[model samples]
Target: MDESLLSIMEVREDLMVSPIGDSEPALRSAYFLKPIAKSLDGPVSKVLSSSMTMSLPPVFEPKDWPLVIHFDWRRHTKKKWVEWVDALQLRYKSVWKKVGIFEAIMSIKCSIAKDQNLCFGIAEKWCAETNTLLFPWGEATITLEDVMVLGGYPVVGDPVFAPLQSHEMREAEKKLILAREQLWRRTKAKASLSAWMDAFVNSGSEVEHEAFLATWLSMIGFSSKGLVSTLVFPIAVHLARGNPIALGPAVLASIYKDLTLLKNSIVGMTKQLVLGDKLELEVTLQSPFYLVQIWVWERFKNLQPQPRLINHEDPMMFRWHKVKALKIDNVRLALESAMEHFCWRPYVQYAGKFKVFYPENETLVLIDTDLDKEPTGLLVSFATCLRVSLLVGIQSTIKKYLPHRVAMQFGMDQDVPSCLPRFDGTKDFAWKNYCRPISDRSLYFPARLFEGDITTRYAKWWKRSLMGHQDFAKNMGHQDFAKNIVRRKRSPRSPQVSKANKNGNVDDDSNARKRNSDVDAPSGFLLKRLKTVSSGNSAQDGTIANESIDAYVPTCKNLSNPSSSASTAEYENVKRISPLTKLLAKDTVEPLMGRLEEDFEDANGSKESRLSSERVSLSGTQGESYTF
Candidate 1:
């Protein structure tokens, strides 16, 4: 037999026949026959014994058991042993098959785990051994490689037992702690100065770079704490190399202290100045800045029984009066000319009232109230007169022909009367005097009163003209009744006219009548003659006979005649009036001149040509005289 078989038979013989198996003679004898047979095969038996000893039983079973004892030894001991040999062979084949399958499974797990960087390969080997020897199928297997993979690292193979450097690991741990500390410090600093820090941190270029870092960290399962440290390291190195972790915290703390100091200072100053009953020192020290200056000045002027200590001559205290006038003589000439040109009789009566003077300042004031009792019409006439006078006054002043600077200085101080007032106060003398009772204490005294009976005569004339009434009753010897009602003249006993006469000179009635009648009769004749001549062919004959007569005759008469002779003569006169009127009308003068030029051009070639012809005709007729 083979050496391994001989050793196996010897071990089987020893275990199959125990000393207690003497009663079983055949079994004992069979067990002794195998060892005796193995002794006879000397060299083979030794080699077989060594080889068989090296062979172990299934890891899960005892190696000392006899094959015969496990099977039936009584029946055909020799055949039974052969059968046991076949069964053992079958068991070895099955064990080999299971081991092969286990090894194949382990190989597959290792290949897969390596590719996937998983720990299952190591675990599979352990699992096979555990299944065979310990728990069999009771528990699953795990490996150190599996643990490493689960903890988020790649496992190469079985974990080798090696010593780790304690100092180096501790140093790594300190680095991580310092990184975390620096990261927290930077985060706090950024939050502390978030408003100003956004200017740098939120830059487009930096944000994109930071975003890439954040994504890379995420792929490795790094937390934000780790990423903050990694990203802020370079910034800390550049800004604060030594003790980088403390740099950001220190900066933030210092900034906070500065802000607190500023806030406290502002609060302290505000408490001292704004929350007190006393006048602010700054305002109290500056006299011009004080409110009392305005109050004192106002009281000094307005308080009754003024103290002698207050200077009356102070320019601030003196109220300058400015009186403006529309010269009556000039205004009368303008209105008369307008009436004559319109071919309308003058319905307005003038009272020979002239000369206005401010008693307080000796300032002369002249105004035109030429339109009888019609206030609006008088206002319109006054406005026209004022406009012309203003233009002339401005031109003359610019030429230094009038005291314009003095007038302007006075105007600056004079407070113009308001169009309306809340109450009849001292400022509103007209309203107070007109509306309030004379006996009332609040009645205002006029700065200057209008004297003479001009307004009374105008009011009567206006009533007559507007109502289309005649003076027949007054002429019919019922003068008293006519004056009392139709003319609205005062009753004989009323004191208004008596007072006026007392205050000023009363005109002689006979002299006034004589003067009015003479003037009226002559003016009526001249106007009638002008109208008739202007409407007839007389103007044409008159123009030919002597063109010089055109200059003396009114411009209205010349304009009425349609003949070229009359147009040419009228154009000349209008041109002469143009430059003078321009100086008086300012802005309106330009448009008027343009119209004149256009009219002259349309009539003849141009204004210059028409004027030349008229001038020649006038010069030629200068030696002759013509009757109107």
Candidate 2:
């Protein structure tokens, strides 16, 4: 057996049961007594015949009933009869009470055992005697079956009963639910935003190109009335260069729809270009922002009536001013005026310069030359306007010959400048005096207008203005008069005295008088010439010749006996020679006129050379005069 079971058995054996004093012997005798009354039975006969029989405990013989414990019924009958009646009642009540007590004890034992096994088992099984133990009086009786039903098996004792707050538990549950909900929402939103941003950024190049195309189309609506194939061709070129294919279908659809409507006259020409065309057509569907801008502008045009120009003179004069101001009805006429007036045809031709073609509208579409088609048509920085202006002449000439009423509808005013000089001078002069006005509110116009020659002139004028003086002398290159004056200052002596002295034939008085006379002559005089080309039908070329070669030839009489006058005369000849002759003279004169050539070369080398020579001469010979 298991050790625990053995221990339980030992405990059960050790339990001592004690009996009541009066009932102890009787109970013992009853338990020990064995009856032995056999008469001629088969077992007694066998025992009598047996030679030897084992001795056994004495069996009790049958006893004639000896009434030792008896009640005095006869003697006390009369007295007891009366008492018997009372006693009988008392005995009946006692028996019933004892039975009830036993039942109560049993009930209490059962109830305690069911609810608490340790207490009930200790009281019932460990007691000295049944009568010695007492249970509470009037305790509610519960049957063994009822107690068993109420208590199943007792649970093992627990030590901790930690209470949790209702509010805290609820809050924990709520937080979990909210966290899950927020995470789900954020995940979904992030995905959506990511998709939108991808589409937006990816569409950038297409959007830019489309915006340019729309601008071109709007400009083209002004002049001619043809589905100009050239204007629409660049779109195909743009697509061929590996632009995203997503924009293709939509752009083609838009073009087809607009062209269809335009062919059918379902919408007016201006409306067709601006609103209906854009919304229905998909040109570079890549950029939502650019597409939206084009759509908005188109819708703005759609709400207006067709633009009409009353003036017939200048086709350049668009009626945009009136359209911008008017507000009756939900009409916007500014776009219509732009479509009617702006020359879009030139843009088409402009695109042609870079090998791009677009469809032609009523007006010329002016392509900006600066725009590059690859990598999204970015304008080449410096070459745009020249190309755009080249096509403007063609558009202008076409507009000039259109019918007056049609021209008036286009708002063309023929008030061009009659004299090119006046126009050039006025425009340049006005630009010089006042800052150039913005052309059509575009930021790029000022840069385009004053480029190249105009820019150079403007810079010169600006420098002059800042310096506070204009260079008024017309022929600033001429230095003959200045050179002559310089020579005169250096030589205040007569050439004749030098010549006579060289031949040893000069008288002092005559030489002095000649020298005085030479000093009195004027130092120099400036001669000015003005040349003008006549503006006449006869194309004549003019040439003027002033051959004065004798004046430049130097004489030996002037050179051999040198004086300040002879040196001055040689210097004057040098200055009068053309730069070509001076260059040639450097080689030829060196051999022919040795010292005189050296003197002339020294004077003519350069300002720096002259200054250096002067400094050397002053340092080397303080007061002496050396003439060549």
Candidate 3:
């Protein structure tokens, strides 16, 4: 906690931008880098340097996993389950919207593609101490903004543990308990997820909808072992009644926890390598790590695959559906040189157009029957950058959401982040403390939020920090920050001195060219190289995993097609039969009002066709649609 980097005396005020008299900036940058630098030695460094030529240890796949291997419920998604989901979309569309999980459910229905090989490599480089990837260029990590925009979780909402007391909620909880008990009796060991789902899902019971949400939380939101954990009952019941939950923070917490676990596993693996001991390695990651791979693909140009271009109305992850990528044998070398190619603000391009997906207001009235007029997904993006809040995850898991730590992800200037006092309240009181108003507004100007701006102070501090770890810098070839990097600046000299220097055989001109090319190479070159490799034939390099992105594929069809109106009409017909239609007759659920205004084209290039809404097949087809 650097006193110079913050104004701790002023309560409820912006800390980073507020000036304090004569205090030095926080020196924690080196503190953050030390652990990362230490981890990059011995076997880890040896493996990365030679991964391109030799077969290295399979860091991505461990020998044994504690929890269920599947990250999604796609395998359990039968025809009956798809039909129930359709009814759910129609029945409680407002419930889903209030909870900020509409796009998440849509992405889940599309069944996110997975690439098992990408996680361990990326996770090995993660620094849990600072929640960033310690690259030679600077710090970068997945922020709450990534969770909001890419994972479709809302940044502003009621806490996950907000108390609920209603007849319907009570009944839902009871049903969940009964289902778990029934499964326990059948197994005589532990509760079975499959048995519980088969018993309650789409059974025409009043609580079936709640059961569906619980299944999602178990499989997607809060992953667990084979058992149907009772942790999701409260959340599911709250969501079924059209209440808001700050799911974005909770989901981000899970990712961070899993990343720390993976990092620790690598440390353990390296220790075994040094001790001359052969042990079966086991890695356990129980979150939607697909999003982690997606984050890497989105920012690092060299790692990206060719992705399909879909309408903005679609979830951003859909762009990478079933996409392919070039197999990079040397990940560390690519990451070391990825400084210029990284997109600091990838979501900036969709700034004005994608506001429809987020909420505009900080406060939401969840119980109101008229859900049509709720604020769109605009302001939450800005709020996520300014707020200091706590995120509560499954089974009482808690983590802090410190946006200031990675402010650059939100297009703000980088600085030493301020620290807050730990919440000392009781468990019941602490769970409800998440949705308070943001105290900092010094850097909230919307116009400049996506400009990819930086400050000289940041660059100088970053350079000094990298230099502190001289060994890591020199080994990774960070020539720009090397001790010998600075040379005598060329200034106008007398003709006699210039000729005298030239006569001594000094090649200053070539030296200048070499330094300029390495240090100030144009960004477009790497970007173009990324695109070329993305479009190459798949036969050139075998697909690493079933999941990865191709960031440059064209959209399936034109957005201005004449059949757009018919698509909207068809979508409206499905909404007309919603169970909530009569319940909230005053304000009908509007037809795909936001991004769906432009009809999304099927993969076959058809102008006026849509997938059947009846059932979703788990055939693992390239263009399966469960949009209904």
Ranking by lDDT: 3, 2, 1
Clashing residue pairs in candidate 1 are 3-48
Off by over 4 Å in 3: 1-83, 188-190, 356-374, 418-433, 440-443, 448-450, 474-628
Question: What does candidate 1's lDDT look like per residue over 451-558, in tens digits?
Answer: 101112222322332233222222111122113222232211100110112323333333333433321211101111111111112232122223332232222222
Q: Whole-model lDDT for model 1 versus the true structure?
A: 0.18
For each candidate in the order shown, give its overall lDDT on alpha carbons.
Answer: 0.18, 0.19, 0.48
TM-score between model 1 and native = 0.13
Candidate 3 minimal-lDDT segment of 10 residues: 491-500
The digit string of per-residue lDDT tens for model 3 on 361-395 reads 10111112222322443333444434455667766
The candidate, 2 or 3, that scores higher on TM-score is 3
Candidate 2 residues 1-628, lDDT tens each? Answer: 1121111000000111111001111000000000111232344223212111211112111121110111111111122122322322332334322221112111111100011111111112111110011111000011111111111100111101112235643343343334334534656633221222222222444332222222222222311221111232233223222222112112222322222322223123224444434333221111111111222222222222222221221111121112232233211122212221122111111121212121111111112112122221111111111111100111111001111111111111111001101122232232221111111100011100000001112222222322221121110111111112212232211111111234333234344344434223222211111111112221222211242323222112221112323232232222111111001011111111100100011111111111111211201124422221
